[model samples]
Target chain A: MNVKVIVRGKAKGAVLCAQKPVNFLGGIDKKTGLVRDEKHDLFGKFIGNKILVFPNGVGSSVGAYTIYSLKYNQSAPLAIVCLKADITTASGCAISDIPLVVAEKKDYESLKNGQEILVDAIEGKIL
Target chain B: MELTKEEESALDGKHGETLALAYRILVAIGEATNADKLIPVEWAHLSGVNYNTIGDAGEEFLSHLSKDAKFRIKTTVNPMGFDSDNVSKFHLDEEFVTKQQSIRNSYVKMGATPSFSCIPYEIFELPKNGTQVSFAESNAAIYANSISALKTNKESAFSALASALTGKSPHSDLRDEENRKPNLTIRMKTEPADEITYGLLGYFAGKEAGSSVAISGTKGLDRRSCKSLCAGMGTSGSCGMFTLGEEEGEKIDFDYKEMARVKDELNTSESGDIITLGSPQLGLEEISDLVAKLKGRSFRKQCMIFCPRAIQGQIRNLGYDKELTRAGGEILYDCCTCLTPLVDKENIDAVVTNSVKGAYYLKTSNGVDVNLKSLHQIVEEETK
Candidate 1:
């Protein structure tokens, strides 16, 4: 079963899961696409061209630009899977044309790093 | 979601690529949030202006957008990466200036006001109560909703940019009065008279509210105090906007016990080398007050006052800039310590500020030591 579609797009990529809330702004390096926050679980991990998964977003309204920056630099994730979708991540996904899915609690728990996933946003499926 | 004819046309690409992209973003966000339709917005206050925060990729994104887009509504930008005049003074390298200035040029090319500040409400002419607009900055959005009575979603910078291009936003949540009615109420034990109390109230209330609408029972909060409270609340979580004073809701009694805990959390044992103010952008009066306090004294370490360029000019005209600089104060413009890498670059071990939001970000996001103090206390400690 897939999560609810927040932004309608289709993508398939390896997973990069973050258990805690992700602060995109100042949290990730735009050029390198690496998570910069030393405190984050996925610190030093590159998010480019993956299916990024996090619980939700936190910090800085400017974080939306970080998402856009990721896309502009060709480092944005292919899709996003979150436990709950907040306005910050939603706006980022919408503007950047990134497929965003808010998963069920069980589905969110089951998601793991490096899991090859296919996101069908129109049909609302994850395979 | 229902879209008006013009909006639909814009979404359909009849109005060109810029409007179409903006429309698409609005529609997508609206659908996700279960918005009924689009509503016209009078203004947009944009964030994502700093280069140190947004970096090279963000500069490219803004450039591309501005190449094809012109704002449909009046829009104001947030602070830039560095104070232009103080780039060398702040010890910013040459490349940093180029990248940061590119961001400013893009937004200015797209017709956004060069008024760089997080507190855009003061720079722009705000609409009457119930006026619909899009604001992305957390503190500014809270201030607009709670104090100015202007309706806005605590929008992200991307959405605010879309609203600027389309002059419309998804009609959801804060746009409607019925939805804004408080679901959680924090009843304070004492009147929140000081800035610290207001900040604590906001911090405590944010946790209590937690994705639910909240209102504070504390009354007679001055504008700065209200702002401080909201800034604290914003740091706790994405609680959106909270109401101050009594309103109908589920009441949560808060007393001195809660205040004590919050106070403890906000402070640190470490001494700070730098005194930075205005994460939410200091007001004109606050700047003046700081100037008056630091009239003759010279600080041992750097004292940085972060504000917009316009206000910096205003202070310079009033001769406060000279007094502040003479007393070892640097009235920096465009960026604050919270949003930029200046603190880390300068190797600032610690920071002391009156801003609860500022302190929270410094600790959590920036990974810097922070000690919270009232403006009066900070002034006393720094000046002497």
Candidate 2:
């Protein structure tokens, strides 16, 4: 089964799931695109070109620029899929030109790490 | 989203690529939030200035935008990486100073007021009640919405910058009258009498409300206490606007149990050698109060206060700067201690502050664990 969500850009990639909220500013490394915070469950994993999934963002208005920085460094995720989109994540994805979609909690909960998911942002669908 | 004729022209590339991009970003955000149209804003306050916070990519983006772009409306900026006048005392490395200056220079070139403090509400003459603004810093946005009665969403740096360039934000959430009313009521059975207590109350309220709320049953809060509460709630919750003494919505008791739990959770420091203040820049009165508290006493640990250059000038003129120096403390400018790298510097193992946002950011942004305490408590423990 598939669900519809608010989509900003269309992209396809494998899923990299994080259960906790992300603070992109210092939480992720700009150079390597790896989650730097030891406390985060996805620690040491590179996020580049994956369909990154998190519950939401936490901390720092600079989180917006970190998204842009990730893209500029060629290390941004192919797309972001959040259960609920906060303003920080929304602005980050909007400015970075990264495909982003906000989905229901049940739909997000159904997603598994490493599963190939299609983010059809133009039509606002996840299949 | 519907765009006015001028906005459509800008979208059509009449206002150069910088503004065209700004307009497009605004349109995209507006659509996402279901905004029906774009509205003009009188002021824009930007965040994401500190080099430590934004790093190289942010520097590149700002420099690129600032090259040909100028702010169409009055704009103010958040703090940068270090104190410009007291760079020598801040222990900032040469590379950090250079990058910080570059960030400052780019914004200055782009026509933003060199107001390198987060507390723009205190520094700038805010627009009248219901006047729309585009503000990025959480604390300032909170103060604007709750205290000043101005309207603004909690904007990100990108949206705020876009609004500054185009002087328009998508009309949604906070702009509408219906969304401003409090849906929940927090009746403070015990008044939040002190600034620090207000901070805790706000932190708790935001956690519980999880949305717009009205605060009641408390004695009238002074400006400082109000700022503290707004900042606290904004940091912990998504809602920025709150009303005090409003007679609406489901009411909850703010009793001793809630206060005790919050105090136990927030007051976590056992030993703090580096005491820091000013999450939002301290007002002149706050500085004066600190001076009176010091009373020529010396400190066992280093006490640091953050403010902008203008406030530092006032501190000097009033002779409090010298008094602070005598008490093993000094006032630094051009950055907020929360956003700067000063907290992570050597020999600083523990930190004490009164701001929920300050403690949260210091841990998240710098990885420095902090304990929340009032200035009075911090002063008593740190000073002789």
Candidate 3:
């Protein structure tokens, strides 16, 4: 499917789709890459090395630095796919050099947790 | 998106690794927002200073970037975790102090002014109206776009830092005149009587409006009320700017019910262990007004007032600081109520505050209950 490339990279991994918007700063554990927010649907699940999928980011601008920290801590997702890209997600992916792409509504809805996928952000495509 | 030769060269690392990263950030945002190009910015007011807000990862990132990056335009910064002078008085953690200092040093090394204020529009002289600047502090961005007649999208910490380094921002969103019009009109059914009420109105409007909004039935808002509105609007959602008068759009009513709903969410406690004021740090005029209100009266409980250090200096000169001190009000500078280390859950069960932004963060970020009251109500009830 076609996508909007945010950061240029290629990655293949199983998906961890979050139904709600993620707040990186407090919603995820930087050290463990686990969804720590109890309110989040993906609670207790790992994000590391997976293709993380969510609608977009919410909350503090510090979420950008949290994403950077996740990469530094060696717990970053292999790639990220979102429906709408807000400033928090865009800048975080940019600074961390994470593979990021924006999918259309239909494509986003089709994504399922644990589904194996290839994200070629460099080519702006999902396979 | 299009880039100038210089921008391309910088992006390609000719300007060093830091500049390349800065350009990369701008390019990514410009692309995501569908901007045709970047435009020059005159100033940048940045956030992400508080250690509590950004933590260790942010500190390391800033330290690495500050090694080579220098701001190209005028830049101001946000508040740190605690008041440096009153660290011992508050008994803030030693590790927190060291980390917070490192963050401060990083910004200073990057050639950013040590303003340590969220309300940069009040402390510094503004550029001419219609000028473009980058402001990451949410309240300041909204105030600039709506009240000061300047142009800016509500920037994030990284984007504002990128703008400070590159002296340019992506030309999109509120930066474009066409996007600045209100998409929704919020008609006030009940007149807002005070800053807190105006703040509630702003909070309700932000949730209901789109990118921009038109707020009718409110006029001649003083600086305090205006700042409160900006702060409340900024805290609730991503909505950036609001026009004061009615504009053609889908209309919604901000009646008594809406006001009560917002207040119900923020005000969680009947009474509080202490009283706190200032979210967007108080300006000189606010301090003067506060002093006038506290004439010959003392707070029944501990009252903490946060203001910019520059304003503190002016108030000190005018003896207002002395008078406030005499009235049992502890004046803290270079910090505000939101995310401050001073108001810990271990130290205080709940806080009484007149700021909507303050009440929200105090409860969620600081982990304490909030007793919300108008400034006038606080003065009348808390003083003896």
Candidate 4:
């Protein structure tokens, strides 16, 4: 099911990914390629292959750098979609060089885990 | 990717060493954040107090800046790494103990203040809002700045502090036309009807609605994945563990494993029944009061009290560590008291807390009947 999603926040657009499960709402310390928080659900797992989903983000300043590190290590996520597209995500996306998109209310919660994400951050859709 | 003349001057070590370090760090952070220019910052709530987290980076950085020492700006910093006492808790593993202590020693050897309370603002006043403040804070501090005080805090404290010390930070906030817009509107729940403490009320209000903690608004309230090993509870200052009346129930729900882990830590050893968390932020007044209360009560020795590291150091400075050590004063850190702290939960029955989050979590996490009294009242009832 290729669903086109639109989100209304700071930055809204579409990319090549759509409604992928937002596995965790934290970071994957791009430098070490390890999930930094010992308490997260996906604590030790790598974010290399998953279609990572989240609202904006919260936690360490190491966040943006971690994204860059992930990209450098060839473990970056396929795409990113944020509910609140703010500086934090913007900076992270700019560095990791990952495909970016924003979510529309029409596709926000409806994008369940395990779905493929085809997004256009500029178009603000997931098709 | 671009630097202004002022930024380049700091980067090229034009301003003194402290500012230079601040610039270097903030430049890295800004680049990480994809900002092309810097913003002005004066007051910053810097974290790096804890070791490990802010330990190595802080020690190395500060050691260099403060080394052949002098003053760039007489500034205050609230570091995130370990303070002295955090290094000495849960000595179950000597190796872990040694590592923690060494790192702590390194941080302190420099000029960093070991004022290990989450609420630096409570202890010392910060600059006012629209005051062009810069700060480095995580969860609670970020919320306090963005919502409680409506100030501007960067992603983390390190970023904020670096910017503040150097006089420049991210060019992305407030100035960027496209990014200046806002979203997410979280409503703190409690009314000011004397129904709850202001702090506790806000926490509960957010929790009751399963509020998502945000930079400004409320959209990210989802709690589908809070089971990470580090369940962080923010502090306003150094508070006792039994402090309560906050609203975490709506925000978090413990799983079966978490529940068990929660149950396990409530148990304390009854070696001589005179258990006490080591000192620094001593509830001495509370202790005096508690002793008075228990003058004629039973189980006088079956008492426990939480003492902070600052108080412990004071005791050591006063030549009393050996005496206090002999008096059965054990030590604990505030962070480890969360959902399940790998302690014996069954043996303990009473608790005393100064931190609203601590008291509330203990009561909510366990069926333990705890008290949200002042440091004095806690000592009084328990010691008495």
Backbone Cα, N, C clashes tallied per candidate? 0, 0, 0, 77
- Runs with alpha carbons beyond 4 Å of true place in candidate 1: A13-19, A29-50, A72-75, A104-116, B189-193, B210-212, B217-220, B253-269, B292-298, B364-367
Higher-scoring candidate on DockQ, 1 or 2: 1
lDDT tens readout by residue for model 1, B40-65 = 89999998887766777777778887
Query: Model 2, B1-384: lDDT tens per residue?
Result: 888888899888997888777876787668656689999999999998998878888887788877888998999999887787778875777888888888899999999999998888887776777899998887788788888888998788888989999889989877788777888898887643777778778878877774368898767587767878887786665677788885565888778898878777656566666888888778788889988987777878777888777676778899988888888886778788676787773667668887766776676566676777777776787789
Q: Residue pairs in steric clash, candidate 1?
A: none
* Better structure of 2 and 4 per TM-score: 2
Error of 2 at A119 (Å): 0.9
- Which prediction has more favorable TM-score, 1 or 3? 3
TM-score of candidate 2 versus the correct structure, residues matched by position: 0.92
lDDT of 4 at B279: 17
Candidate 3 residue-wise lDDT, B1-384, digit = tens: 899998999999998999899988998888777788999999999989998877788898899888878899999999887788888888888999999999999999999899889999898888899999998888999999998889998788889989999899999988999999887898878765689888898778766766799988886588999999999988776778999778886888888988998999899999999999898788999888988887789998999999888776688899988898899999888888988899999979999998998987887668799999887889899999
Q: Decide which is better by DockQ, 2 or 3.
A: 3
lDDT of 4 by residue, B1-384 (tens): 577887788767777666665565555445444567776655555444333333233344444544543322223443222233444443334543444455444434443354553334433455565455554443334344433353443445445545434555676443344432332222333222121123333333222221123221222232110101001322211110111123222233323343334323322222222233211123333334333444444333432334333344544565444433343433333222322222234755645443344433343333344444333343455443
Order the candidates by TM-score, highest first.
3, 2, 1, 4
Among incorrect, acceptable, medium and high, the docking class of model 3 is medium
Q: What lDDT would candidate 4 get against the real structure?
A: 0.40
Worst ten in a row by lDDT for model 4 chain A: A3-12
DockQ-based CAPRI category assigned to the predicted complex of candidate 1: medium
Ranking by lDDT: 3, 2, 1, 4
Docking band of candidate 4? incorrect
Query: Between prediction 2 and prediction 3, which has the larger TM-score?
Result: 3
For model 4, what is the alpha-carbon lDDT of residue B24? Answer: 56
Could you give the DockQ of candidate 2?
0.50
